[model samples]
Target: MLDCKPASTPIEANHRIKADMGDPVDKGQYQRLVGRLIYLSHTRPDIAYAVSIVSRYMHDPRSTHLNAAYRILRYLKGCPGKGILFSNSRHLSIECYTDADWAGCLDDRRSTSGYGIFVGGNLVSWRSKKQSVVARSTAEAELRSMVSGICELVWLRLLLTELQLYKGG
Candidate 1:
């Protein structure tokens, strides 16, 4: 989509994408495109959430899903310079921020949880995934996200210690 018009955002905000909404599209093509986007998300955190959403319908992709995937491609074309930046800060501290929405998915009423881990004031790790269980309340959804974030933080701490880069709690 080099010559295609660029999209301002990767995905439309608050747009509910149902699995069985649009007509069926070529499964192989959609999967291959999303697979490439998944790899690209490793370096472009801006498209992580969008890529995750499109990756969900890889098994039985519809036209709606394909359009969303194209929007991500358009977004990438618009902002080619966007990427992660890791600076060498004098002080090394780990900070994780997480958030979740209650019943964000209309199809299954599953809340989506996301977290971004910053090390030395630069984003190092991040993830956006739907919770396995259906949370009855917003508080419950948020709690689940917090637990996931803490788990990642703990893992990162252990890794830093192993590499001799961490000295304090």
Candidate 2:
């Protein structure tokens, strides 16, 4: 795909990954591609959410999943130099935001939760994953996401404490 056209975005906003959208494709190759994307997401937060969504189909990837994977690759190609960028800042503070797609999954109706933690206005940590339990209400879904974020915050605080980066808990 070296000569393939690259895309500016990893996936289209309106795109959906239905379980039975298309014919089944090679599972091994699809899994490998998703694995590489997962590794890349460590530093490329822009693609983290998209990669997480695509990785869900590793067991039985369809042609649609393959296409979505290709779109992510194209996105990387278009923005070859895109990655984490840290700026010089004396002040550091942890600010978190969380959200959820209440029962957004088309097949089993599992909600997806996401959180992003920013340090001094720059993103430092993020996650996007399917919720363990099905949330019956939007409020419940949001609470679930907030709980995940709080866990991350607690861990971050502990890490900072161990490193002596923060003065107090």
For each predicted model, how many residue pairs clash, with residues at least 3 apart or on different chains? 0, 0
Indicate which candidate wins on TM-score.
1
Lowest lDDT 10-residue stretch of candidate 2: 160-169
Stretches of candidate 1 above 4 Å error? none
lDDT for model 2 comes to 0.89
Residue pairs in clash, model 2:
none
Report the number of backbone clashes for model 1: 0
RMSD of 1: 1.0
Write model 1 residue lDDT over 16-56, tens digit each, in one string: 89889799999999999999999999999889889988998
lDDT of 2 by residue, 18-136 (tens): 88889999899999999999999999988988898898888889999899999999999999998988886766677899999888887788889999997777788999999999899
* TM-scores, all models, native as reference: 0.96, 0.92
Error of 2 at 94 (Å): 1.1
Clashes of 2: 0
